[model samples]
Target: MHNLNAIVVGAGMGGLTAGIALQQAGYTVELYDRVKQLRPAGAAISLWSNGVKVLNRLGLGKAVADIGGQMDRMAYYSSTGETLTEFSLQPLIQDVGQRPYPMARTDLQALLLNRFGAEHLRLDSTCVGIEQDEHSVTAIFEDGHRATGDVLIAADGTRSRLRSEVLGAPIERNYVGYVNWNGLVDAREDLAPKDSWVTYVGDHKRASIMPIGGDRFYFFFDVPLPKGTASQPDLYREELSQFFKGWASPVQLLIQRLDPQTTNRIEIHDIDPLPRLIRGRVALIGDAAHGTAPDLGQGGCQAMEDALVLTNYLQTTNISVEDALSRYQTARLDRVADIIKRARKRSDVTHGKNPETTKQWYANLKHEDGRDIMSAIAHTILSGPLN
Candidate 1:
């Protein structure tokens, strides 16, 4: 076992995965979160092959498969109910050697917490500041308490307070000029194909539904809107109805069947790629380092990749801690930067911000087999460190 103790801030997917990987690597791990009760920040996460490979390495493969949705096909449709394209996911699944899991965020969080052991987690401990010396790093909390460790990892998310101190300035998040409302609803075959991940798109708007475990569907509605628009939770159903009005029957029915109480509404925002990801003995991971838009569905998957790669560096190298962290930064920076850029472009195209590009994409889908799409996805998955 390595004679090292590590402190991880935030109990999100990235932090929990980090804590788990480090613990398995023989580092004593301590985790803290700002929330009094642990809850998911979003409705669900699309755990692609790359992310699943990490989870399998962490010894959670069967458990994840049991709780994740079985997605067999993917289909895209026009808002008027015309089928734009449809394809089986088997080719991609066979290429990657694993199926993607669209698991509910809450279930995934619970699975991580259960595997990591709840006792190691400290809740309601909001981190306020961090300080490190030649030998150790200390995290200061809002409750006037402190914890010291061999290294500190700030997985405190996109609005990471520690990131500002590391970078010597506050970084602003760029809003993509849109809002996303998401939730889970009980699966009804009448509303959507229960075994397929389906998307309906038109008029700079999109609505998607994917099967999740527990006989339910995870759904999202995305539309262009001014930043900082207040979310009217009470009017969720009505608001969605208006935005998707006159769309296909599936969309109309899905909105009508949604329960407002279980829905979440928020403006989408992401940070510009940082020039660096480490400082002293502290390193940033996940959204703290490279928060990207969800258009690529790689945000959570990348975080999982970060945890595994960071752990691999620390375990395989005999170098100093600082050197290991610097290597991690070098290994991660460019890859995450590319993902951020791709996600932003995808967001623009999906939202109809570039009409010509959007039209071309829709047109191309008509004649193309699923080969190009699957190849792109396979490339992204194969590019990960584990593969």
Candidate 2:
């Protein structure tokens, strides 16, 4: 096992976690990312109990708890300041046996980078292509450097170059029909409850603020928009105001308090679940394998799940690496596919893709007691491999 080498492309959560797990299992690991400096793509990640369990398995539970926000409740609000429903998440925590940690993405990435050992990860090395034979696989970089190993992992993300290579065709990215603007802001009780994830909903749009580390809040605005909606610098606040006009006071405060310089305006998109996650010895993990809309807050969680599943399958030293990868896909493909589809459906509902469903959901929220929401989340957590 010590002689075996694993070449991992992309140093995102999934990639870094896999490298650490594989190294722990006695593989000499080669981790690479195309970026010159590693940074998270989003402001924060809502690490549900399932993801925290993965980090706990990797021995980073304490570190995560330290940086994580104190999110004990999820509350829904109408656009005009009326509370729709609110409930403590204690039952879900008890059901899942772990508390959810909604933390800043930068903090999580830095922790992972530190845990994975920064010296071992190769940065600014863009992996352009991959070559594999029955015995080995090679990752070819754009700079003519190549890393060959016993197995290759493609975790490069939604725009993964290696994903197209594995499928032997161009990958199609489907627009989820909404734009997301997300960033961090200094936490203020007037804007949102410091320990709660509060979302304001109406007119097929959402303005949400969730607690994050360091007394800051992770804020995001979602609106159904035509693809290719133009974004202008210095106008983000005005643009948001127009969209969320007449919303709650807190939503207004969030728009005013957040810094436009650090805010990210992104077109939300997700790839269809691939027909396969493995091609010979090269396996796709994370966004590279199954990119999904963020509606379920499980995008990063699923990637963490991928890291764990891949490592588990490869732990048995006697089995061929190919067989392990095959097993990994067999265990992961359907599960991830189900999640991706479910997330997409959620996006549709949240963004009013089907007006009737969205209307009904809004009506139902008035009488909701949070049982259904917690139950759905608990089901997702318990269905993971660790359970």
Candidate 3:
């Protein structure tokens, strides 16, 4: 084992993953989070094949598999409830050698948090700034406490305070031209297949529900909307009902069944790729490194990949900490930027930013076989460092 200790800011998925990976590499890991109790930002995350691969490497494969949704089929419908296409995801799984797990964010978080061990993680500690010298780095907290380590990792998320310090300016997030309302509900066949992911598309909007663990389904409604749209507490049901009016039965049922009070209403946003992800011994990962629209459901997956890659460099290279971070940046920058750009373009097309393109996409959906879609997914999974 190398003689190194690490400080991780943020207890989100990426940070926890990083902590676990680094610990397995025999590094002392201290994790800090701003929240008193961890609450997931969204309802669920679609852990793609690539993401699952990372978890498997971290030795949490069976635990995650047991807690994740068994999503093996995907279907799409038109506004009038006509089936566009339906196909089993088995082919993709076979091709990629791993299955995608669509699980509740809460469960995923708990699993990672447990694996990382809560004893080593500090809560309700907000990171204010950092100071690094030639030999070590120190994280300053809002409460005037400091934790110094061999290296500092800013997995603090998209609006990371440390991001500003590393980049020399605060980067603004670009709105993806849509309002998303998401929540979880008990899985019922009337709402959607218990094991299938279903989506209804029309009018520059979509209502989707995917099966998750614990006999429940994770659901979301997406509608094109202007930025800074005003929202009120417990208004999700009424707002989604109005926006998704005249849609299919499953879509209506999803909107009706999901609780308004617990639902999360968010305006989607993604940042342009950063010029770099490392500054000396301080490195960025997850959303801080490459925030992307969730159109392709790769946000969490990419973050997991970041943790794995960063850990790999730090453990395997036998290089200086700074050099390891620089190698990680070189390994990650281009790939994550490409995924972010693709997700942005897909978001634009889905939300009617290009009306013609959106129309064409809707038309093409009717003729789409599950092959092309699965092929595309397979290509992405294969492209990740896990392969």
Candidate 4:
């Protein structure tokens, strides 16, 4: 019999979502993070219909809807401010049974953390090592304490130590030859239209603007950079201004208002898709399993879906730990791998250096009924494993 205890190795979206699903699946789950407090470190996260579907299973869909901003449409434009294509999000909203919302990444984290009280979560507890045998797993902490559980879930993100232990060396974090900047600007009444999201594409760069809450819009910029380039913190804002000099309207205004401290610059990275996501009593979830560029906004959603299905597998099957882990891997690998591939391809097509070709591609997608495409993808997610 598989024991009903689990240790989750990170407090980010994947870890907390896993804890919730496992605990509710009759497991006693203890979640840990190295950070003293779990505040929102990044800008905003889009709760695509798939993400909200998992949230609905948790009974927090309404809470997410309450705090998140809804958009009826998404429009794409050229850097010269010419409209290229547009699509309605209404069909996707109806298919998921909930409207897609853009909530401040911090706000969503706070809402998820409240589901499990502080007692189940240990802040500032760093997991340094994981030891496992045929039956149980033990986690070694940096503070000189050890805790054992039936299973250890490594959601510790891209630089996972548990991953290193399982694979026997540090896996290289591959950069995509681009860096992204993101921040949430204070809601300016005169700026961005309400209830709509916009993305503007330029040669070798892309910018996204979307509402996250009542007044705030989440903005992201992905700019091309040479591989292995280090960015200077002190000159980020000035560098950004110079990098995007004389782009589009509103975007120029938005960039002008950003506080240097609030903006974050990260080199986009992805791990080559793994052949498997589990090893004995330890299984990897989220980015640890498959990290990819954010071009598709499916990273968090895919992780939440993994957590849900993993819990379902463990609860429904009277199988050994290895069997359960294997089942989880079986259920997730292909779907996630396909997504990773699609996301990489989409990034290439979206930010293609040849502006004319990129424009032609977007035009073709626009004319092909994007709502139908979204519906098909949604069906794949909701019906694939959970059904």
Error of 4 at 125 (Å): 2.2
Q: Which is the winner by lDDT between candidate 1 and candidate 4?
A: 1
Rank candidates by lDDT, best first.
2, 3, 1, 4
Q: What do the candidate models score in CA lDDT, each in turn?
A: 0.90, 0.92, 0.90, 0.79
Clashing pairs in 4: none
Clashes of each: 0, 0, 0, 0
Model 2: ten consecutive residues of lowest lDDT: 310-319
lDDT of 4 by residue, 219-318 (tens): 8888878777677667877787787787788778877787768788888888878877888888889888888778778788888888887888788877
Candidate 1 local lDDT, 127-229, one digit each (tens): 9999888888999999998999988889999889889977989999999868999999999898788899999988888999999999999999998988776
Off by over 4 Å in 1: none
Residue-wise lDDT of candidate 3 within 1-387, one digit each (tens)?
296899999988899999999999999999999999989889999999999999999999999999999998999998879999999999999999999999999999999999999999999999998888888999999999899998898999888888988888899999989988888999999988898999888888888999989999999889999899899847777888788788887888777788888888889999999998988889999998888999989989999999999989988776589999999999999989989999999888888998899899899998998998888788778889998
Q: What range of 10 consecutive residues in model 3 has the weakest lDDT sum?
A: 232-241
Residue lDDT tens for model 2, 1-387: 346799999998899889888877778999999999998898999999999999999999999999999999999999998999999999999999999999999999999989989999999999988888988999999999999999998999999999888788988899999999999999989998899999999999999999988999999999899999898748999999999999989999888988999999999999988999999999999999999999989989999999989888888645688898899999999999989999999899999999999999999999999999999999888988877
Highest lDDT scorer:
2
Candidate 2 shows a clash count of: 0
